[model samples]
Target: MNNIATTLFLGKGYRVKKQVRKGNELRVYIEYEGKQRCPRCGSENLVKNGKDTKWRKKLHMSFGFFRVYLLFKRQRYKCKDCGKAFSQVIPILRKKERFTSFFKQAVIFWLIFFPFDLLSLLLGVSRRTLLKIAEEFISRVMIEELKDKERLVIGMDAHRFHRKDFALLLVELLSSLPFGLIQDKKKAFMDFLLSLPPRVREKIDEVVMDMTVRYRRAVEEILPHAKVVCDPFHLISYMNHQLMEEKRVIEVVKKRKIPGRVLRLGKEK
Candidate 1:
């Protein structure tokens, strides 16, 4: 059972000592698989001091519909080489954390498509916790992924989600993945582009955006080598507006000529 648990869920370097099931909740007692080594000195010459009797419960990925928790009693060891005492680190959970890495990742994945309130109820976690997980995950992803791009085709656009507020979104055109969002202001948009490294800015060859004069100016100033292309939607909207204005003028002229033509025909008859 320990071997199977280690292979399936608990991962290597952990052995399941015991398991208790109460309805849909599962409590698994786990410990390190090998001899306890001193973290400070990395030596096996250590004496058992005592057990950390604190209540440590780690929330893990669910098994089907059942909630799983890993309960562990951390072992304290006194190192002879370093003359210090330290507790064994749990590989599955970070220090001072209640959830496993895998569980946090799962929550982030669900949050991408589901509302926070709905996900919170489904996962039995508080809404605040779900939001924190998402924020940290997105921050890490953006820092790691966006900075290292060698070449890019970016797109910028503004959207109004509310009546009086607007947001500017920046996306990688090739992948259609959003990288940044800020208030729909010229300064905000310029600052966001300027925040990137010079190498990254140089690698941007093309930017697609609407015919906003501010957007065009900012891109030209920051990315001197990049070409800016106007999106088709803006062009079509402009053409439609001009055509409507011409049609109104033509209708007024025809209405004015019709009265004169009727009067002349009446006089001649």
Candidate 2:
């Protein structure tokens, strides 16, 4: 039981001290192993300050639909060298977070494929918390992926999420990863493009988008070096419409000539 509890709830550098099963929830009490050390001063010479007055409860990833909670009394220690007091760092939990790192990671993964509300309900976490996690994760990833690039090829598109609200999406064409989503009109779109670094904007080689005049104009103004390529779907659709109109004109001309031809033939006869 101890081994399973340790493997389930405690990560490296941590050991399970005790576990209690209450109703549907499993509460595993945990503590750090080895000598206590100060985080700031890294001194092993320490004295017990006191046991934390409040129980710190952290939510862990569910096991087979049963909720798991990690309960620990964060031990406070006073360092002799630095004369500073700090609580022992929990290896499995992030600083000042109510959920374990494993639980936060699971939430980030689910937010990619699941609806926010659905994930919140399934994980028993608030929707606002889930959104905040997703936003921070996405922002970090975007900065890391885009910060060092010298050149880029981009694709721009928009989809209507509401009657009057549209979301403009910009994707890196080579990587096929989205870089930006602007929820506004053409003015906002241009503003976003202009907000990019001048060197980065100058590095844009090509932009692929639907044949919207506003988008074309914005790209031309903001990224002077980028060659704008209209999406083939829109180009093909336009050509098909033109071809149908020409076919209709030919049919009308043929109908008009038939009566004249018949009259001439009767007069000759």
Candidate 3:
């Protein structure tokens, strides 16, 4: 329509207007501008040769059934001075892509911020794709933020999602990054820990975990300098349970106060 309309379409966003039907042909009105120069070659000698219209059925703004009016204005070019003749390109959306890049980015952002399964169901994508996107995003962030000298504490443990008993996780405490996941077995956990480079292992300061004897053995064998702190939460839970049992025993002794009970209690003490 105008330069301002084209600029607005380039800046914020654009949507389909309508599809016009004339006699035996269909013409679609899209919020797009006339063809311009190639971004890389900077050529301006171009003309509109033909147009292709595609009917895309998409959910319209949450609660409506509508079709997308996509008019691909193919351009022809003649640049005898530069000895080049090419077609003017539309660079905003890629060819064969069902959705725009901006729309894909919005979907990715939603997946990163929200829960994966929920967002996948809402956006009509697979959970595997959601997880792959999240993992790639996390890997990029970690690569940017992780420093050579930063202290990294990796906690290794087995986690079970369901009936499968063998699921191991290596979680980096400082960066909150997942190092690796393997089958919940000693050999798998040992291999993962051993696979870390010397420099990375040296950066580790402490590893806090539950009182698993196998884990303690592995830590002592592998990380000599790193402090293995028995998780305070688990320790406190165990101590509280022991104290309750002791309190029950004392209450029983006090309730029966027989001479034989006292002597037996003294002997047990």
TM-score of each: 0.54, 0.57, 0.41
For model 1, give the 10-residue run with minimal summed lDDT: 260-269
Model 3, position 176, has a per-residue lDDT of: 80
Error of 1 at 91 (Å): 1.7
TM-score top scorer: 2
Q: Rank order by TM-score, top first?
A: 2, 1, 3
Regions of candidate 3 where Cα sits further than 4 Å from its true position: 1-149, 156-158, 164-166, 247-269
**Model 1 lDDT at residue 117:** 64
lDDT of 2 by residue, 1-269 (tens): 45755567554566777788998798887776656778888889999899887778988876445788988887888999999999876666777778887787788887678775577678877665765565455544663576578778888877553455556767888878776766546897887777666676777899999888988998888877899998788888787677666555755866542333434345412
lDDT of 1 by residue, 1-269 (tens): 66757544666678777788989998887777557777767889988889977758888866445788888788787898898898877666788778988799899788678776677778887765765575456545663575677778988888653456666767888777677666688997788778776777878899999889988999999888999998788878876677666555655866542333434345412
Best by lDDT: 1
- Candidate 3 pairs with clashing backbones: none
lDDT of each: 0.75, 0.73, 0.56
Clash count for candidate 3 is 0
User: Global lDDT for candidate 1?
Assistant: 0.75
**What is the number of backbone collisions in each predicted candidate, taken in the order shown?**
0, 0, 0
